[model samples]
Target: MTPDEYAAALDAERSARNDRARYVVCEEHGAHALMRRNGSGQAWGVARHVSQETAELAAAFLNRLKEDEA
Candidate 1:
């Protein structure tokens, strides 16, 4: 990779661990859930919801790294 591409890749990896959430869809269950990236780079479920808004709200809270807590 070029210098810029390598830097961008590193930044993306850092963001995924620090402050990122995924909107997971469970088609089998017909529901959506908020999945947060854990310290160990695993998918951690925060909450499940039938609506998009609620799931996103939960993701917002779980994804942020509080300055006080950090």
Candidate 2:
């Protein structure tokens, strides 16, 4: 492949690794956490949404983010 195309592919791989999210449960505490990568590419807990409304809002926020999905 061309140099520019190879660089673009490498960047895509890095960005895909950096931009992602997931949810996890703490069985003992019965708690939920929203984990995501921030602009600085650091994985952090966005919040421990304690209420249904807050949880839905967080979901909406993620949906609205629209990060040029491939």
Each prediction's whole-model lDDT (CA): 0.59, 0.56
Instruction: Give me the overall lDDT of model 2.
Output: 0.56
Residue 64's C-alpha lDDT in candidate 2? 55
How displaced is residue 24 in candidate 1, in Å? 6.9
- Per-residue alpha-carbon lDDT of model 2 for 1-70, expressed as tens digits? 9999999998898577545543322212454555554456566665676665566567566745544343
Candidate 1 on 1-70: residue-level lDDT in tens?
A: 9999999998777765455434343322667766655455577565678987777666666445342233
Q: TM-score for every candidate vs. truth?
A: 0.46, 0.35
Indicate the worst ten consecutive residues by lDDT in candidate 2: 21-30
Clashing pairs in 1: none
20, model 1: CA deviation in Å? 8.6
Structure candidate 2, residue pairs in collision = none
lDDT of 1 at 44: 59
